[model samples]
Target chain A: MAYERKIGDTILSVDQISLAFGGVKALSNISFSVNQHEVFAIIGPNGAGKSSMLNCINGFYHPQEGTITFKGNTRRHVRPSEAAREGIARTFQNIALFKGMTTLDNIMTGRNTKMHKNIFWQALRFGPAEKEEMEHREVVERVIDFLEIEAIRKTPVGTLPYGLQKRVELGRALAAEPDLLLLDEPMAGMNLEEKQDMCRFILDVNDEFGTTIVLIEHDMGVVMDISDRVVVLDYGKKLADGTPDEVRSNQAVIDAYLGVAHDDAEE
Target chain B: MFYREAGQFKTSYRADQGILTIVQDRFVIGAFAFVAFCVVPFFINDYWANAILIHVLVYVLAALGLNILTGYCGQVSLGTGGFMAVGAYASYKLITAFPEMNFIVAILMSGGITAAVGVVFGLPSLRIKGFYLAVATLAAQFFLVWVFNKFGWFFNYSPTGMIVSPPREVFGFLVTGPQASPEARYLFCLSFVVVFALAAKNIVRGRVGRSWMAIRDMDIAAELIGIRPLEAKLTAFAVSSFYIGVAGALYFNVWLGSAEPTEAFDINQSFFVLFIIIIGGLGSILGSFLGAAFMVLVPITLKTVMVDGFGFAVGAAKHAEVMLLGTLIILFLIVEPHGLARLWQILKEKLRRWPFPY
Candidate 1:
C-alpha cells in the first residue's frame, strides 16, 4: 500500500560533517536533510559509515567540523538527551530493549520525559506518581495496541522472538512521542513476514502521526517501497540524494550500493 | 482451585495494577501485616522479640536496600556495612548531641547523612561497573569502619570505644535504651521496616524503578533513551544507603543497645545481606523478607537441633550451625536459582493446577 507523505520544511539538516578517529575518516563532509513528515532513508553497503552518520546526528559522536540543524536551530553538538528532549528519539541498530523488563514497562520507560513527578511522589506511588504513571500508561497502551503487541505486554523482551523484540524497541521509541524518529535497521534480522509488518507499522507511524523519520535500512527493496526520499552513503561520503527511483537509476549508487553485476543482470 | 484466580478478575486498573495484583496475593499480604503488627507483639516472648524478631526486621530493611542496588539496579557494592556504619554513627551523633531530638528525627537524619555518603561512594559507578565497582565500594566499607574505629569523636571518646543508645520514647512508649521493653523495641523496628518496605515497593513499581532497571540492563541505551545514568545510579546508591542506614540506626539503638565497630557493622553484615537477596530472589520485594526470614531462622533452628537433638557442645553446635546453613543455602540456590520467592510461586502455580496438570 502506498502511504502518501506530505513534504514540508526541513526538520533536520547536516552541514559539511566530517568525523574521524585519529586520521581515519568515518564520515567526510557528508550532508543530508530530513524534511517534515518525510520517510527519509539512509542506505549504504556495510562499513559505509551509515551508523556513524546517525551517531553524529544524535550527539553520541562530536564531529571535528560540522553543524547539525534541527527544526532550523543549528548547533555544534546535540547530546543524545538534548536531542531526545528536542523530540528526536531513536531505536538502536542492535535491539536495545530492556531485556529484564516486561514489554509494557519498557515502553512506559520511554514516557520518562513526560513524567513530571519526582522521587518524593514516586516513593509514595499514590498521589502524583500513580496518576502520572497511569496517564503515561494510557499513551504506552495505545502504542502497544497500534503495534499489535498487546499479547506480549506482560512478557519479558528477553524471551520474545527477535522480530517482536524489534517491534517493542520501536514501541519504546514511539512512546516518547518524538517529532522525528530515528530507526536504525529497525527490521534487520527478520523473515519476510516480519519485515512486511514492520514496514506497514513504520508507514502507519509516519502517515498517522505525521512523524518525520530518518531510517537506516540495508534492504533496498523495503527502503524503496517505504521511504519518500533516499540518501546513499559510500566510503564515508554522500553518494546520491533523491527520490527512490532517481537514486535507483543513479549509476554510482547502483555500482557502490546495489552492485554492478546485479544492475547489469536486471537491465 | 482455591489458589486459582479464574473468578477473581480485575475490574479496574488499580485492581489489576499493584504490588499485589491477585486477590489471593492481597489477602496474603494483608494477613501477614495483621500477624506482624497485632498478633506477634502480643504473643512473642522477650527472647523472640528482642533477639529474633527485631533482628529479622532490621536485616529485612538492609536486605531491601542491597537488593535495590545489586539486584534491580545492577550496581554491586560491598559497602552495606560501611553505609550502615554511617547510619549508626550519624544516629549516635544526632542522639548524643541533641538530647531533645526525637528518635524518628534522628533516624531520618542518619538516613540523610548516609545517603550523602552513598552518593559520594556511588559517583565512581558512572565511570565503572561490575566487580571493579564492587571493589571500589569495598574501599568505602573499610574506610568507614576505620573512621568509626579510629576516631574517638565518633564514639564520644568512650573508654570502651562503643556507643550506647540513650533511652528514647515514642508516644509515651520507651523505644530505645535498657529501660525499653523488648516489645517496645520490636514494635519500633517493625514499624520502620513496614514503612520502608512499602516505600521500596512503591518506588520499584514506578518510574524510578524503571529508570534504575534500564540503567542496569544497558547504560548506553538508557542514556540514548533519555535516562541519565548518573542520576539513576546515584539515586540507587542514595536510596539503598538510606535504608541500610536506618537498619544500622535500629540495629544499634533498638536491638543491640550498644555497638562496637568490629562487632557490629563488619564485612559479615554486607555478605549476610548479599546472601539474603540471593536466597530470597533478586529483583523481588517479597524476596527481601523471605531471604531475611530464612537467614535468621535457619541458623537458630540449626543451633537448636545441633545442641539439643545431637548433644553437641555449644561451640561445636555454633560451628555446625554455620556449616549446615551454608549447605542449605547452596542446595536451595542449586535447586531453584530464584530462591524462596520462586519456590513460593511454584507452589502457588501447583495449587492453581490442583486436580489437573498445568
Candidate 2:
C-alpha cells in the first residue's frame, strides 16, 4: 500500500522512515505528516507497524532510513528526553504510571522537564525552588481538575481501575504541555461510558490547547467520528490516506474489509 | 480539628506542595530542632557526650548515606561499611603524608576518595537488580576491606596494621588525639553531622531527589519520562559513599581515636546501618535519624537496665542485650514493615484526629 497527500501546514513530516528488528522488517519506508490542531488517526490491522510508527515519533525506536522533521527540525538520533524537551508527549499502549507514586505525583513527574530548580533551594525549602514547585503543582492540579480526578488525588496509580489509570496516564502527558500529543489506543479496553468520556477529553484538549493529536485507535467507529483525516495501513504499508468518507469508500479498503466482489454477482 | 488541612485552603501551588502544610507539623519540627541543638548539650557530661552523641552523629551520617542509595534510588547496597573503610584509610594516609593539612579538609577529602571507589563498585548495579545487586555490592564489602588490610601503607606500615590518630585541632584546640577533651570531639562530630544531614535533605528534595524516586518506583517508566538511570544511580552512589566515608572518618578520628581495618569498615557495620534504615523508615530523612538513634540506644538501654538498674552480671547482660536487639529488629519488621517512620506517621495521624478514634 502507498499514499500521497499535502497536509495543511505540516507540524511533523516523516520522509521514508524504515525500521527492522533482527532479520524482520517491522516498518518499511513509511511516510506521513500530522498538521497542527488536527485529529490524525492511524488505523490499521494488527502487525501493520502502527506502534512502530509511534515509537519512531517519540524517539523510542530510531529509524534506519530517512528523516523525522518536527516543526522544521530534522534529527537522525533523538532520545526520549530530547523529544520530551522539544515538546512531544506520549502515553504508552500499556499504561506506565509510576506504581508507588500517587496519581498527583505521577502527573507531577510529567512536569519534570518544566521544573527549573536545583537541589540547594529544595533542601532549604525556600526561595526560587519553593516558587518553582508551587508553579508546577498549580499546572498539575489544573490537569487533575480538568480530568475530574480530584477524588483520587492521593491514590497510588497502581490501585486505580484500568479506565481511571489510563485517564491518569493522559493527565500526566497533558501536564507536560506538549505541542504534539501522541496517544496509543487511549480508549483501549474501556467500556462505552469511559470511552465516551475519553473522546470528549481528547477533543477538548485539542480545542482548548490547540494541540496536534496523532492517535492510533482500533475502534473504527470512534476513529470515524473524531478524526479530521485518516491514514490506513496494511502489512507495514500505507493503504489509504484521505477524509473518513473517502477512505471508507475506497475500493481497496472496501475489498480489504469486505473482500473482492464476485463475478457471478457482477453478471 | 487541629491537625486537619480542611479549612486551611491553598490557593497557590507553593502552599499546596510544601513539606509541611499543616501548622502543627511546623510546630513539632521546630520543637524537635530546639531539643537537638540546644537542650541536649546542656544536660550531658563530657564522657556521656563523647560516648553517646559522637556515636549517634556518626551513625546518622552513615544512615543518611544508605537512605540515599537504598531508600531514595531503590538500589539495595550492602557495601556501606566498605566505603567507610575507604574513607577512614584514605584520611589516615592523607594526614600521615601532609601532617600540616587541616583535619576537616582531610576528613572531607577522604569522603571524596570514597565516592570514587563507590562509583567503581556501583558499576555492577547497571546490569543487575534487587538481591543480585545486593550480592554485587557484597563483593565490594569483602574486596575493599581485604585490600585495605593487606596494604600495610594505609596504616603507615604499623606492625599491627592499626592507624593511631595524629594530633588534630580546630582553632588551636586539640580535638582528635587521646589528650583531646571529649567535649571538643563531641562538638566536632555534631557540627559535621548537622551540616551534611541538612545538605542530604536538600539533595533529595531537588531534581536529583525526584529522579531517584522515579527510578525507585519504576526504571523503565522513569527512562521514558526523560530521567537517565545511569546518571541518577551513579549520583546516588557517589553522594551516599561521601556521607558514609565522612562517618568512617569521624568514627576513627573523633570516637575511637584509633582505627583497625577489621573494625573501621566491616560486614557488621553494613548490616548495622542497613538495619537502622529498615527499623527507621526507607526513603525518609527523619527516618534515618530516628532509626540511627533507635539502633544505638536500644542495646545501651538494655545493658544499663540489666547491669546497672538490676544486678545482672556484666557478661550475662551483654549476651541478653544482643538477644534483645535482635528481637526488637524482628518485632519492628513484623509489626511495621515501613519501620519507625511509619510509626511516626501513625502517631501524627492520631494526633491530627485528636479526641476522635478514627
Candidate 3:
C-alpha cells in the first residue's frame, strides 16, 4: 500500500535508515515519520531497535544508509550537537543527571546549547554574562516549579529519589527548548502514582508548548492512552504504522507481540 | 529564622539568580575575601609569606588547573607535573630568547605553549577514558620529562642541565632571580592565582563547564543532549594545561629561581597535585585551594614538631612526614571519600543549624 505524507507537517522523516555493528545488524532499513505537535510512540519487543531509532534521530548514532530530515535540515551524517542545535532534545534510557551537581545546576546545563557568553565574560561573571545566566536561571526555575521539585532545587540530583530524578531529567530536556522531544521510557520504573504524575507532565508539556513528542515505551496502556499515532517494530523492521486503533487491530502488530501462528492454529 | 529568604523578594530575574540569594552567604564570602586579601597579609611574617603563603598560592593555581581536568571534567589525569614542566621550560626558553620582553608576557606565552602540548596529549582521550585514559596521560608525563632532560635547549643549553634564572623586572621592580623579595613574589603569585581561579570558576559554571560536567557524568547522554565530546574534552585539556603551565612558569621563574627538568616536571609533582585535589574534593573550586593548603601546611607543621621542636634527626623527621602524609590520605579517603571539602561542607551545614542539633 502507498500513502501520501505531508512535507511541513512531518517534524521528523526517517527514510531507509540502517545501522550495523561488525557482523550483526542492529537496525535494518527502518523508516518512520513523526508529525508536528503529535504524540508518536515507537513500541516493540526487547531488542527491536526501538532505542536505536531514537539514538539515530538524536545523532548519537549515524545510520549507514538513510536520510533523517528534521525541521528542513537534511543530512546524511549529523552530529548530536548539530541535532541539538536543530532543536532536538532527548532524555536517556537511563537517568543521566550530573550526580555531583544540584538539580538546579543539572537543569541549567540543559540551557548550555543556548548560552552564548564566552570564557572571558563568564570569568568576570558580570554585565552581559550575568544577565544571560539570570535569564537561564529563570527558565530553569520555571521548570523546577512545573515539576514540583522546588524543594530539591539545591539538592544534588544523585541523592534524589528515582521518580524525582526522572522529573529532573524531563526538566533538563525542557530547558533545551526543543521543537522535537525524544523521551525514552520516561515512566519505566515508577509506581502507579508516579506514572500518572509523569503522564500528566508529559501531556502538559505537549499541550502547553505544542512540542512534537517521540517516545519509546513498553507500557501498552500508557502508549495507547497518550499517543496520537503508534509505530510497531519487530526484528529491526517496521511492522505497522497508523493511529493507535489502526495499529492495535493490525495482524502483523499482533503477531509481533503475541508470536506467529505455528501449524495453522492451536488445538 | 535569620537565614530565611521569605521577605527578600526578587523583583527581577537578576535578583533571583544570584550565587548567594541569602544575606548570610553574601556576608560570609565578603568577609572571607577581606581576610584573604587584606587581614592575612598583615599577620603573615616575611618567612611564612615567602615559604608558606607563596607556596600555597602556587599550588592553589596548579590545583585549580588540575581540578578543571580531573574534577569538573571527570577525566582523571595523573600528569600535572609534566604539563607544569612544559610551562617552566617554555618560560625559561622564552626569556632566554627574548631577554627584553615583558616577564608577564613571557610567562603567559609559556602557558600558551603548554596548552598546545596538552591538547596533543589530550587527543588520546577521544578514544579512551577512565583508567586507560589515565595511563595514556602517564605516558605524556614520562615522555615530556624525558624530552626536557634529554634536550639541552629546553634548559637554555646549560651544561649542567639546569636553567638559571635571569634577572627580570616588572614595571621597575625586580621580581625574578634571588634578589626579588618574598612579598613581591607573593603578591605576583597571588594576583595571578586570584585572576586564574576566578576564570576557572567562571568557565566551570558556564557553557564550557557544563559540557565538561556532562561528558564526565555520562558521555552517551551528553552527546544526545547536543554536546560534542571531542570539543568539550579537548577544551578542558587546553584550558587545564594552560593554568598548569602558568603555575609551572611561576614555580620556576619566581619560586625556584633555577629549574631542572627532573625537579620541575617530575612525576612526584603530578602525585602531589593529584593528592591535593583528592584530599580537598574532586570537582570543587574551593576544594582545590583547601586541598593545596592542607597538602602544603601539614608537612611543614609535621617537620617543625618532629625535628625542630622535639629535636629529632632531619632524615628521621623527613621519613615520618612521608608516613604521616600517606596515613592522612588513607584516613581522609576512608572517613570521607569526597575529602576535606565535604568535611567543610558538613561543618557549614552543621553551623547553619547551630544551637539545635536535629
Candidate 4:
C-alpha cells in the first residue's frame, strides 16, 4: 500500500441524535465522529437503523433531537438539496438510478449542483449554457471512464444488470465531487469479484480525491479490511465505536452479532 | 446506408452535443427547412394553408408545450386549453390596446403572461403528482374557460362575446385579420414554430431538461442530488405554458380570426393536445410534431378518402372519421405506448445496424 493519506480532524459529527416515527424509535441517542479522509463503516443487524442515520446526515430525515456538524457548520434541519450543496452525496440501498435516462445522463445529473445556467440560457443552448454543459460533460466522461462503464454509457440505466446499476449509482454520486460520500450497502449483494472491484474503487476514491467516506455495510470481512474505524449499532442504539481491531475485540459487539444470551441482552 | 454514423466520429464534445449531431440528420433538417420556407409558400393555396398546414403548425406548438410538462417533467397537465385561452385573450388585448406594437412582440408577451398563469396553476404539482396532478390541471382547464366566458373584459366586452384579431401588418405585409393573405399567415406561424421548436429541443437537452427528467424519474433522489423540485416543476409549467400561449395566440389571431371563449378554449381542446403527445411520443420534440401532424392529417385524409374517393356523404364521412380516429389512437397506444418517437428511434437503430442487426 503506497497510499500516504493523512487523517485530519473530524469532518462530520453527530451528537445526541434521536429519531422516532410516532411510537417506534428508529435511532436513539446515537453519536459518532468521522475523521477527514478516513474510511468509516457503520455495521449492525437488519433493524439497527443504519439507513435512517444516513438519511438524517443527508437531511432526508429530521431527527427529533440532534445536531449534525459538517465541516464547521452545525444544523438540525438541513434540507436534502441544501446538504448536497454543502458537498454531501449519497447512494441508496436500492439502486435509485433514473430508469428513463442513459447511464451518461444519470451521471451528468450528479453535476446538477455545479451547474448554474438558468432555463432561458439553456433554451438558447449557446455561449454560457453550451460552455457549462461541455465542461461538465468532460467531468462526467471521466467518471464513466473511471467506472469502466463506457460500453453501457448510452444504454438506459433500467436495462443494465444489478451489479452494473450499482456501479453506475456510484458513478453518479462521484460525479458530484462531494467531500462526504454516504454509501448505503454498496456491496450488499455483490459477488466476490464485484465486491473486490467496489472495495478497490472505494479505496482509490478515498486516496485520489481525499473524500471522507461514511458507509454502512453488513460484511464483516469488508468492514475489517478497509475501514480505519468502525461503529456498531443495535436496535437504534450505539453499542461500540473504535478502530476495527478494538470493535472486533469488544465482547458486546461479538454477543450482538453471534446472538448469545438474547434474553439477558435486552435488559 | 444513409442513416448510419459509423464513420462520423465526433472529435469534440461540442460537436457531439449538437442538436443534430449526425450529418444525415442535419442534412435532412436543412432540406426540410428549405422546403418549408422557400418552396411551400409559393405552392400553398388558400385551401391547404387555411385548412391544414397552419392548423397543424399551431397545434404542434401546443403539443410541444404539453409535452414539456407531461412527457419531460412527468407533470401531467390537462389545463392546456385554458393556458392557450390566456395567451389568445392576452394577445388580443395587447394587439388592440397598443395597435402600434409588433405582432411578434405581442405573441412573445402573451407567452410570458401565460407562463405566469401556468406557474400559479402548477403550485399544486409540488404537493400532488400523477393522476392527482392531472385532476388539478383539469380543474384549471374548466376554471379558466369559465372565467373567460363569464367575464366580458377578457373578450373586450364584445356584444357578440367573441374576441377578434385586429388587422395587423409587418413591414407592409398583412399578417392578421381578414385582409391578411393565407401565405403571410402561414409564414408567420411557420417562423414561430421553427424557432420555438428549435429552442424547445435545445432546452430539453441541456441541464434544465436533465433536472426536469430527474424530477420525473425519481423526485426523492433528484432532491437528494441537489435538484430543487420546486424550481424544476414550476419551470416545466412556465415553459410548457409559454409554448401553449404562443400557439393559442396563433390559433386565435392567425388561424381562427375570431373566437368565443366557450366554443374555442373548451375541455376538448385540452384533450386534443394531450392526445397529440400521447400518440406522438412523450418527452420527444419530434414526437410533438409527428403527433400534431397525425392529429391534423387524419381527419383531412378521412374526408378526402371517404367523401371524395369513395363518394360517401359528407355527414356520414365526418362521423366515420371520428370513430376511425378514436380506434387509431387506441391501436397506437396498444402497439407502442412510448409513442411515435420511440418507434422512430427503433427504426433508426435498425437502419444503423442494417444487413445484420446483431
Indicate which candidate wins on lDDT. 4
Report the alpha-carbon TM-score of model 1 versus the true structure: 0.97
Question: Where in model 4 is the C-alpha error above 4 Å?
Answer: A262-267
For candidate 3, the docking band is medium
For model 3, how does the per-residue alpha-carbon lDDT over A82-107 read when each residue is reduced to its tens digit? 88878999887789888877888888
B1-358 per-residue lDDT for model 2 (tens digits): 5677677787766666666788778898889778867777667677677667888889999999999999999999999889988988888889889999999999999999999999989988888999999999999999988998898877888998888889888878788887887667777887888888778876776667877888998787677677777888998899899899999888888888888877767899999999999888999888999999999988888998999999999999999999888988898799999988889888878877899888
> Residue-wise lDDT of candidate 1 within B1-358, one digit each (tens)?
7787787776755666777777887898899889988888888777998768998999999999999999889999899998999999999999999999888999999999999999999999989999999999999999999999999999999999999988999988999888888877888888899889999999988889999999889888888888878888999999999999998988888888899998798999989999999999988888999999999998988888888988999999988888888899889989999888889989999999987886
DockQ, prediction 4: 0.89
Pick the winner on DockQ between candidates 2 and 4.
Answer: 4
Candidate 3: pairs in clash:
none
Give the DockQ (C-alpha) for candidate 3.
0.67
lDDT of 3 at A256: 77
Please give the ranking of all candidate structures by lDDT, highest first, separated by commas: 4, 1, 3, 2
Least well predicted 10-residue stretch by lDDT in candidate 2 chain A: A1-10
Q: Can you tell me which runs of candidate 3 are displaced by over 4 Å?
A: A1-8, A22-25, A260-267, B1-32, B39-46
Candidate 1 off by > 4 Å: A1-4, A258-267
| TM-score, cand. 2 | 0.88
TM-score per candidate for chain A alone: 0.95, 0.93, 0.94, 0.97
Model 3 chain B weakest lDDT span, ten residues long? B1-10
